[model samples]
Target: MTQVLGIVDIVWRGRNIPVEKGAKFRLGGIKNTAVTYGRKVGRAQEFQGSEVMATTELEAGQRWGNTWDPGEGELQVVCDTGQTFVMYDAFLEGDIPEITGGEGGKIELKWAASAPEEIGV
Candidate 1:
């Protein structure tokens, strides 16, 4: 079966974090930014995925992403075929959780990256 850019394994700042199976991740053009809409790829009959990403937790030394902070870090979306869509200097947009809901309290996270690099599996 040919992979069609579904099922993403996220690698934020080199840390691997896999999202829900129904999660839908998309990357924009060079001028545009990358965004991951939680919690599903498209609207069919699926619930949104929780645990979209890691957020604020100082004591845990876990504050390198989400929060829309600029750490010049990398946000990688590893595809099912092992193809990785890496974004350098990626930072979450201030107003995340754009959806704030989608019938089941689902949300959307927007991210901005300088340039995106796609690697083959």
Candidate 2:
């Protein structure tokens, strides 16, 4: 079964933004590796550590302007399933949409791992 997890809220810079529908959160991990000469085969790889990235999108006009500062701040994402993710060294990405067609605006939050535990999540 495919379980759908919805984002409940996002707290950033001491302000909260209640996420509406169509919110998305993504996390990624990458290893620090390098290709080297192998003994038997052609080449091999050596990996040292991992890097992590966390990102999410939220609806604008709901405390986004007050909380978002480019290249600064941290964010905490709470989901409906009791899962929480802390995004450190966060920064704001993408432009806040402005239109008169009654369409909603969205802001994208991007962050990297700042702690040991956050490097793989």
Off by over 4 Å in 1: 1-3, 30-70, 96-108
Q: Candidate 2: misplaced stretches above 4 Å?
A: 1-4, 31-64, 96-101, 104-121
* Cα deviation of 113, candidate 1, in Å: 1.2
What would the TM-scores of all predictions be? Answer: 0.50, 0.51
The stretch of ten residues in a row with the least summed lDDT in candidate 2 is 112-121
Candidate 1 vs. true structure, TM-score: 0.50
lDDT by residue for model 1 over 8-115, one digit each (tens)?
A: 677777766534556545554523234558864533332322122432222234342443344557888777867777787677665534332334333344456644
| Total clashes in model 1, counting residue pairs 3 or more apart in sequence or in different chains | 3
Cα error, residue 111 of model 2, in Å, equals: 6.2
Write down the RMSD of all candidates, one decimal each.
12.6, 5.9
